[model samples]
Target: MTVRGAGIFGLACAHACATRGARVRVIDRAGIAAGASGGVVGALAPHTPDAWNAKTAFQLVALLEAEAYWAGVDARSGISSGYARLGRLQPVADDRALSLARAREASAAGLWQGRAEWRVVRAKAGWGPVSPTGWLIHDTLSARIAPRAACHSLAGAIRDLGGEIVIGEGAEAGAVIDATGHDGLAALAADTGRPAGTGVKGQAAVFGLDRRDAPQVFADGVHIVPHADGTVAVGSTSETEFADPTATDALLDDVIARAVAYCPELAGAPVLARWAGVRPRARSRAPMLGPWPGRPGRYIANGGFKIGLAMAPACAGLLADLVLEGRDAIPEAFRVEASL
Candidate 1:
């Protein structure tokens, strides 16, 4: 099968196809991770308690499967993308927040496999060493990936497997996987009759800080992820319906201020770089995967929103299983037909 668009989802599909004994060719207009996947830090945390049952189930399986997949990739070939299971911390800002956290803790414990790994802590007096005035739920299941590096590694793996990756504009293929992200469906003309997904712009900055200065990872409204190169990645702002992929001063200020507030060590960090990308967010907040309703041989695995990196491995596996092995059992939430 010929796969077009060698982004995260496309490359993942290509890898899966090659593994499943299918001849594959991946084509992309721009380089890998050129869309939302190009961001500095890609968090692999799945849904919270707010997600629906089907969505939660899919993410749970996907997250677990991705752990094994990344381990395999790391062992067979070195992955320099700084993949770390640093866990996640959802702080309780207030009393209402604390209640919500408690509920989430209960729900997540019941749903997640490693229940004992999650803990809820109380806040202390001072903010320095003291915790917030809420609960701290630390789940070991969450992970992080250096987006660009992972994308490069995946592309390299696709080539290493003897699959072809064509980089040019307006390339053609027998079957195309629209993993180009926010730009993907638009590039494809949306002839498949599926509801066009919405775009959300996110801006983030990479800061060069001492290794000891930054935390492994801290996420609230904004997230801070430390890289192996003594650089801490801080982001991101969610702007709905924004098409421009350029960084803005307002976003930078907000993120920096928030990052320093969350982690005081980064108060005076040197800014390295700043950029932005548009994420394809599905209207129903679920990914669309499978062939175009009426257009045969064309498939879409885009609209992963902010969790594309965490969700790609499983999504790709499912898509390949459907296309190659004639599997019909897709997670009900991710069924493209429902959205169509």
Candidate 2:
């Protein structure tokens, strides 16, 4: 199988196919992790436990399946993908938020199938986001992984499984899957003469805080992720209009300020790296998967949007199942036709 675009989705699909005894070659015009998947902040957070639907349920399955999947990749690749189920912390700003968290505790019990827990707890000191109401939502299902490292590790695993990652374009030798992030989605939008999806630019920054063991914090529309390398990541500014997709500026600084305001412990951390990337966001704002409509021998695995990393595992599995075994377990909402 030839997978185009060597980002998380493409490499993940390639790894899945190669591990299943299919020869795979990944070709990307800009090389691996050259898109949004190469960004610094890698949070595998799930949607709110309320108003559960197919999209959130599918994300739940993917979040639960991520640890073992990435662990297998790290083991086979002999490289650390910086993957850990460290969980996540979210602040409860007021009574209404606390009430919702308490309600979700019951909902998650039923929805998570006893695999994970989402409960309201007292806010911890020295770490975790400060809750104005003294309560926080702690969900054990949330996890984090280094995006670029995970891609490299997936590439390593693919090579170990007898696949190749090549630079530049190549003819499709077998089943071709389009996992090209923003570019592929844009092409689709142009070809269909309608809005399929567009890129949403985001900027993030890495901090020098060595809080690898701390749970990721999501507060004020910002994510504070602690990587395994002892660095903390604070991000991001989602911009639909940006002149430069890869430039960091005041928008990122604003994100850092918000992170610091949420967690005072990070106020002293030095900024290490700043990054910006454009994520592929479909019109449905859900994954656009399955065989590409009206395009024989080609499939789409794009439109991951904000949850691309969180959704990669299940997306790869379902798409690989469709491409390899002629089975389709994709959710109705994630079908390519839905995005079209």
Best by TM-score: 2
lDDT of 1 by residue, 232-257 (tens): 88888889855467756686788888
| Model 1 lDDT, full chain set | 0.71
Which has the greatest lDDT? Answer: 2
In order, candidate lDDTs are: 0.71, 0.91
Candidate 2 residue 88 Cα shift, in angstroms, is: 1.2
Summarize candidate 2's per-residue lDDT along 1-340 as a digit string, tens digits.
7999999999988988887899998999998899999999999998888788999988888988898898899999998889999899999989888888898999999989999999899987789997899888999988999999999999999999999888897767889999999999988877777788899999999999999998999999999999989899988898999999999999888999999999899998899999999999998999999887777889999998998988987899899999999999989999877887
Q: What is the lDDT of residue 169 in candidate 2?
A: 76
For model 2, give the RMSD to the true fold: 1.0
lDDT of 1 at 156: 71
Q: Which residue pairs clash in candidate 1? A: 5-27
TM-score of each candidate? 0.89, 0.98
